[model samples]
Target: MTDERSSTSPDEQRSDPHDSSDGETADADATSDENDVNENDADGNDNADEFTIADFHDASQQEGRPVLTAAAVSRALELSHEEANERLEALADRGALERLAVSTDPVVWYPTELEDLTDRERVVVFPKQREIVVDRPDQFTRAQLSQFAHLADANGEQGYRYVVRPADIWGTPHDSFEDLARTMRQALGQRSDALEEWVHSQWDRAHQFRLTTHEEGYTVLEAQSPEIMGNVARQKLDEEHVHAPISETEDWVREGSEAAIKRILYEAGYPVQDHRELESGEELPIELEVRLRDYQQTWVDRFAEAGEGVFVGPPGSGKTVAAMGAMAHVDGETLVLVPSRDLAQQWADAILEYTSLEAHQIGQYHGGRKEVRPVTIATYQIAGMDRHRSLFDDREWGLVIFDECQHVPSDVYRRSTHLQSKHRLGLSASPIREDDRQTEIFTLVGPPIGTDWEALFEAGFVAEPELEIRYVPWGDDEQANAYGSADGREKYRIAAENRGKIDEVRYLLSAHPDAKAIVFVDYLDQGRELSEALEVPFLSGETPHHERRRLLEEFRRNERDLLLISRVGDEGIDLPTADLAIVASGLGGSRRQGTQRAGRTMRPAGGALVYVLATRGTREEDFARKQLQHLGRKGMTIREQAVERGED
Candidate 1:
């Protein structure tokens, strides 16, 4: 029901079409105004369009109830008679507010007509909740008050109620004044204390809320509900585009969306307790006959003492071997978590070689393969599939080892609250990066098992390689054109695979003629281009998995001195025999990939050389700098020998 024009005042009448003195003009103008209003109404506009007292009243009680009088509602809201009363009736008719006749002469209105009037509202406030009230006594911080107000504002139907009777608040603790303070805060905003004091002093109202001090002189206030204290939550999906499993309940705010709330909860602080409670003296079978290196033993000892932590070891550093050895010495079933199916298969084979451990019992779960037994190697993707439940909730994994510890800090892995293995270990080579969130690896897995990359590399346990970073000039305008797009990957490929890099690769090969080498590229076209230019066999995702393996084997056996591989060679599989790595193209600006690629040539077969070809004066050089920053190199060292003059 829209507002009627019958009660227009003299001021409002001037604007109304019917108020004109010319009788013919009044009817014509009225018809035109009505048509415009009808068109606006058909478009379902309310906020932009003007409303009348009748419209306000009708809007207030569309379901067949008397709407709150505009004059009374306006006075109550303390707005001008016209401004307040004008929209009040229509808002009420639209079910935005409820008309409650508190008195025959003085009517009242309430927002939202919720059933449970005594319900409490929850808000996820930030910074620490404990600190919000710990020291403050005479006053509550603005943040605290605002949080309370946001919660309480929902108590009224439309927004916040200006006045909530004292008797209406229920379930508040005796002598607790936080709820009253919160309510007063909502009504007063920043002027809550004044109103609160006024109410208590003049009206002789009891201060229902109180604060108590602890032995430490910390003021601890009882939990108080928000001003509105209404348990209504927005029906929306989470910020990450993932829907909550329990769609009905409002307890858990969409995960990352409620960071402030989580912070408050964290500030509340949980008691620290050791997650590991290993049973004593009942050790299980130890089958593997493994000779642990001093560094490997040190990693195990640190892991046992640290409770949970990560082990940093480059490729061929025996990270997996050390982890397996540690598992063999410990009792109970071990859970090995790998990144992909290829790694899982590699781990399964490696573990079998170390121990007469039943190969059948060593289960692998990833891709289409499924096996569950005493020992299982599951991929992170499958483990993090169910966000609500833990990955190992149904069963217990005594020792959980994440092969790629860097992945453990990812948001997807963090959501796996069910990965409750207290005795856990993470193995990775390049842990430090630009995205230091990977530092959460400490929180998720444990402290560092290896001190630093250099420590492990120097101790002869991990690989050590001499790095050679070269600038690859672009071929034609192709490289320059690719950099214009937002695709960072293409930018990297363009710079890395520039024709100038082909000459450098040849130079590095000529420089170390006898050393077996593998050229790493990010794109298949780059690899193909390099393969044709250098007359070498190249490997990519398009290459059959078996054929790629065979090609790598041939190169390792000296049948081929050079093998060109795309990013597929960044992880998994092994190249123990390759003594030199030529990084033609790489994942731009990714420090992890840089370290892992460098580690490819760092295997214990004596020290090797690593050459990284980066395009100069482009984003590729910037990415190279970021990758090498953590490598402990303070300055850029390069030998720029242009193979072609003005040709590229």
Candidate 2:
């Protein structure tokens, strides 16, 4: 029977090969014949030959052992005996299976279940240690181990021993101890102690706290470790009696509190990192067109030292020039935020004349143009718009100069300050606001850094002014009735728009024919009527922006000695040549407006004159007194002069 079986047809030999003794070969052939008979009986198909790894896995699981034999797989999958044996060997090399007992006639294979691997089996076969166990063997891949082996061999390093815990080795979690050991061994192959140094560096980074600037003008404190956040919050409560809610990821604070918070964190011994850094600006020329005055130089030096603050100096005391000097000192990408388009243009002109920036480098961001450049001069109105606000989302300004920053108390105007900058400078003649929101400026920018006006005047940096109050009687009884009956805004309008002030404006212009004068009024209609009656150029909110610029230029060139300007000209418009001013109307009890109107003629051209016109024996008298009181606080004396009906 053995000789006949060995000499069996080539087809039978190919189906099930036996290379052992006659009795063993007969047993194998009997088993193969039994498997064929069982398969044919179960499915009645003799030609089916297909198998997969999943079939072997299922068979091992059902048998309650990690072991699966070739004959069992062949019967379960209906594949040829040779095909089953080839597939089993392939799976064992892939780490999915292991050769359990090779001494047996038919080698017994065991499937390697990463999730269920024993401690002994989880140990890597490296020569460094007898026992290096992996906690989770399921998280590692075979490719990772292979790469590690290749990298270690390339570096000519061997016998790596891992002393760190598995959790610490990976810095997070890993499934396979062998794979993790391989990766660490590979990383350390470059140099000795490299893996230990890397783990320590990761721990330090994960524990550190950092501050990042958000688009909404707030700073976010990022803490990756929950334990660190809890520690910080507990310490804050103990020291300051404040309960700060701890977030696993981050906390938020106002931008204004960034300095204070950083200081607190440092004092508490917390490792704090400031993620905000000053961006390197484009290089500008060091030379300046205009030399800084003594006081201006002092102001610039102080501003550079402080980095950010409100600079308070009277008009014509070189506040704008001092700001220009500060910009030159910093020599970075600058953004000048002004309250009006006229001031925006003036800033643009000042930048071009004083600094190395060219016309192309200086862009105007307003209604007409939204060009962006290294230096941007924008009005608050344009910067407050939703579309324009988005333009600054990613911009990092090196310096931000807020010209006439008193306007920042308004909700819409305050939006312009949402931009992030390394340095900030607020320039204002009178930092006070009518709404008593000066504290907002201190919080958003910084506290006031003042320059003495009286000192400047004594030093000849500012021109002394001759202040006068001219009282004009009402035109008729009908005007008196309207002023008496109106309330709220109407009463102020009626009082300010008294028709008799028109004659007073005309007289001031004729009296100062050779002296360049600016006629300032509170109401647009009053300014228009006076401009038409006196036949002079008028500038108001309704005036086209380009035309307004042309008119101011014409006035500067001596073509028009007298120009009629409304309250829009009260702040930030530089009329240095104007030696005389006629204030016919004003917002009631606005100290800022009164001071700005007086400052229009404060240029250093020998001396200047300011004539304030008020309606006699009415509420205008009281409001005028208030304006004069504000000017008096600034060290100006006013002489009252009564106008007869035909004084003009």
lDDT of each: 0.53, 0.62
Stretches off by above 4 angstroms in model 1 are 1-284, 387-394, 415-417, 477-493, 555-559, 575-577, 633-648
TM-score of decoy 2: 0.58
* Candidate 2 lDDT score at position 318: 63
Global lDDT of model 2: 0.62
Residue-level lDDT tens digits of model 1 in 506-622: 777887777778788987777887889898778887887678768866765557777888777766555543677888878474777887777666544355677777777677777
Clashing pairs in 2: 136-175, 137-175, 139-175
lDDT of 2 by residue, 209-258 (tens): 76666676556777767777677744562323222444675676654455
Error of 2 at 5 (Å): 99
What TM-score would each prediction reach against the true structure? 0.54, 0.58
Best by lDDT: 2
